[model samples]
Target: MAKIKALKCKECGREYPVEPLHVCEFCFGPLEVEYDYDEIKKNISRDKIKKGPVSLWRYVDLLPVENPTVGLNAGFTPLVKAENLGKELGLNNLYIKDDSVNHPTLSFKDRVVAVALSKAKEFGFDTAACASTGNLANSVSALAASAGMNCYVFIPSNLETNKIIGSLVFNPVVVAVDGNYDDVNRLSSEVANEFGWAFVNINLRPFYSEGSKTLAFEVAEQLGWKTPDAVVAPLASGSLYTKIWKGFNEFKKVGILEENEKMPRMYGAQALGCSPIYKAFKEGRDWITPEKPDTIAKSIAIGNPADGPYAVKVTRESNGDMEVATNEEIIEGIKLLARTEGIFTETAGGTTIAVLKKFAEKGVFDKDEVVVAYITGNGYKTMEVLEGHLNKPIHIKPTLAEFKEKVVGQTINK
Candidate 1:
């Protein structure tokens, strides 16, 4: 396998050899994967990609890993043209990249972890780990177990039971940290140093984030190798948004497809409970002010998102908008997308759908423009939250009179 060019710090542009590291020693800025794109371009072709598996592995040349991996069947998520939802939003061309149904674990994080673990293997690491709000832990454990690697998963102590079970099913060493996700992250950074494990999000992040680029790649490829006019996605740590933008730009740089028109307008969504990025964007602040998250969208409840500043800059540079929705609005948005399109998304997806609705209502979304909205996780992880909100029928002792009142010619359960 060809060697990766090197790792480069995003802020200071300092370079390091491929290693189990994440931060720059000089400026303390985040480090990211750097590659010899010219080499990748020479080897990558549409026909070559077509012969690969129907997963994100098809874009392995563009990803961080040099070898093929058989992790979760990540990527190549459905790109359904939302004609019905488009009409509802008074738009002509809208698409939903429904990652809610992605592979074994059923979340977009599987895509990233696939590449991260592959890198971990290349680096000769044995143990796999992550500090997750929810989905990342689930992906890490499942992928690690499959690779015959021991795993340690850390998460917020108050996570949803379904999410906890999702990771535990893979039988990892799960730790419920006694605080919010931020607290869990700090602990993981420390633990990563003490324990020589491949913590995917902390140590293997530069490569991990490359997995998200596939979402953007697949979207463009599925749309006949063309870039969309706009994209809307939920922003947590902002990695997804940034990687997506990188994917599209990389496509242009490679000349695999070329359109000299405007780059897509990148919109970001956030639950109002933790919307420091959106607030910073709106207020025209240079740095994001962190906040304590308190929302049902626990997946995206990062108080101090690592990529917050980059997210704001990317959104603004693309002539896009960032919007936040209340928790009530998020629930309604979840129901709306599910009711309209049969896509049962978690709260993070709800945030995207809510933002899409908001922007559409405000006439920000052009009817003629091609738009793609990413739904990152399934609602199954959050189904418990829906219980008791919508009621079960109260039986009159299961009597015939109950049917007459409740089921017979009922309108709105009259």
Candidate 2:
């Protein structure tokens, strides 16, 4: 096995032995798994990674699990050149990491859930559970079923129909809170402590979030071992943004890629209805207050993001700005991407596209730089958001005259 180290607090810097714990007892802040980089550098190499499976397991040396008991073919997704969307946005070089088609489940949540469940099994946990908005529930339920662990998922009652069925299909015990996500999450934390279930994003969070680093790992490697000039992704708990940055730095530290003068700019996108992070960033606040989330992009509608400050720090430190898109703009973004790239993104992905446009218009991206936007979830999961927005095809009599009349002077919406 590789050199197993300890978990360290991100706030007060206290360290603890590796376990299924997420908070530092001394400081009450979040904990993250830490490794001896010097040891990792000595053992990991290009050939070592190349010999592994074609999934996120390729970077197993840096992950938290000592033994991965169960997982799917997660990560190593395609980095597609968005020639059509790029031309529409007037960018010469642009790409899309479309994890909307990610395996084992549709959304990118599979990455984090896979890591969390593997760690849960490593710790000998019998049940896996979480407090989720949508996609995480689906991932936890399905992964728990595959791993033969009893599963329990808590969520708000207002979640999309498909999101509800997605988890229920796995036969997990699904609990719906009458209130919003924050309410359910608060209750879940208390329940997790009381019942000792392996709440993936809570108790096993320190290890679970390491899965997101693969987003950066794959991007850099797919770009011929170089990082892009910029990356735009939706912000929920803010962990994803920070993990992606950490992944690239880890690769550079281990000699898989040499440290260079260039680094990718990280942009965080949020919906206007639940944009506490963006509001805090604009107001120069150091801390964030949790809110009752209300937005079309329910998947990215985290009000009191656990990693909000860290996300802002990374964005500002990288010379990037955070922005929020209106509900209308989010819908337009969904249509824009669908029309140009044939990718039907949900509201969270729409928030990314909408923010990309806002920043692009503000000169945040150079037309020649390699820019990549992450599409995290499929729109089919929330098709209700687009229902009745388009006109039904006109039923014409069995006559060519009626068909020509309906088509005449009516230019295609495309």
Candidate 3:
């Protein structure tokens, strides 16, 4: 494992010792993990990575943990060519970095939870916790179970039923707060400080976020070690978007990708109900103004995102744009992907696909440019939202007459 040299404050440039800390005591800004890239470049190579495990642990050289207890099978999801979707949108080259099929938990949160729990164990903590909208709670609960650690997951009370049950099945103590995700996060932060337990998103954030980089790594490798022209990812707290940018840069620094390779435009997708980052980007502001989320895409419904500013910075720095999808658009996007690619994704993925279509319609993408859109979760977890929206199946009698009359493409008389 590549040892972290320090935890550097993103705003003030102050460095602190490697420990379970997130905020800078002096500046109150978030801190990020700084690794010794020189040491990593010594033995980290494409051949070494390809020879490693078939999971996210294949990039263990870049991850923070030495012995990952949980996610030995979390990363390296498929980067499908998306020919059907591309044809529908009139784009020649498009791909979907599908994480909806991720193991243990059918979402990208499994990647981050794997690293966080490993570090929690490495730090000798037996309790794991987090504040989540939905997917993070499920990932944390499942991984903590595998690691034999006590787990607590705090989430918004209005989360989908399957999401609540998904975490409960893992046997974690689940807390449903009365308010929104931001409210749950605030209480979790206090509990993290008061109870002295490792809250993955609050205290162990720097290490946990490194897990998102594997998404970028898999994309570049799947594209034959080349960065795409653009990438569209759903923005919740915005940590995932920024980390993907960091991941591409890290690969270039380590000689995996060429130093002169053009970086991908880091596009962000959000629900119109809660799009602080998109609002900031549109108004040409450097800071974010919080909003109250009311979208069906509850997973990316953080009204006050902690990493909103950084997400804006990364988007501008990479010459990227952000877009929002309405509730109707989100639902259509979910059905579109299912009909075209046979991938049934949650609202977060729907938001991504909807934004991708908007961008394509606006001619934002070159016909030949490689565009990769991320689908972060499976639709099965949030099937409740599809009620009264999807086309109902046909009902027929169990007879050959009915089979010929209604089942074999027979026109129904209404």
Highest lDDT: which candidate? 3
Off by over 4 Å in 3: 409-414
- Order of the predicted models by lDDT, top scorer first: 3, 1, 2
Winner by TM-score: 3
The lDDT per prediction is: 0.90, 0.88, 0.93
Worst 10 residues of 1 by lDDT: 388-397
Writing each residue's lDDT as its tens digit, candidate 2 over 8-60 gives 99999999989999999998999998888889899888788878889888888
Model 3 agreement with the true structure over 181-209: per-residue lDDT tens digits: 99999999999889978899999998999
Question: RMSD, each candidate, Å?
Answer: 1.8, 1.8, 1.5
Worst 10 residues of 2 by lDDT: 405-414
lDDT of 1: 0.90
User: Can you list the residue pairs that collide in candidate 3?
Assistant: 56-75
Worst 10 residues of 3 by lDDT: 405-414
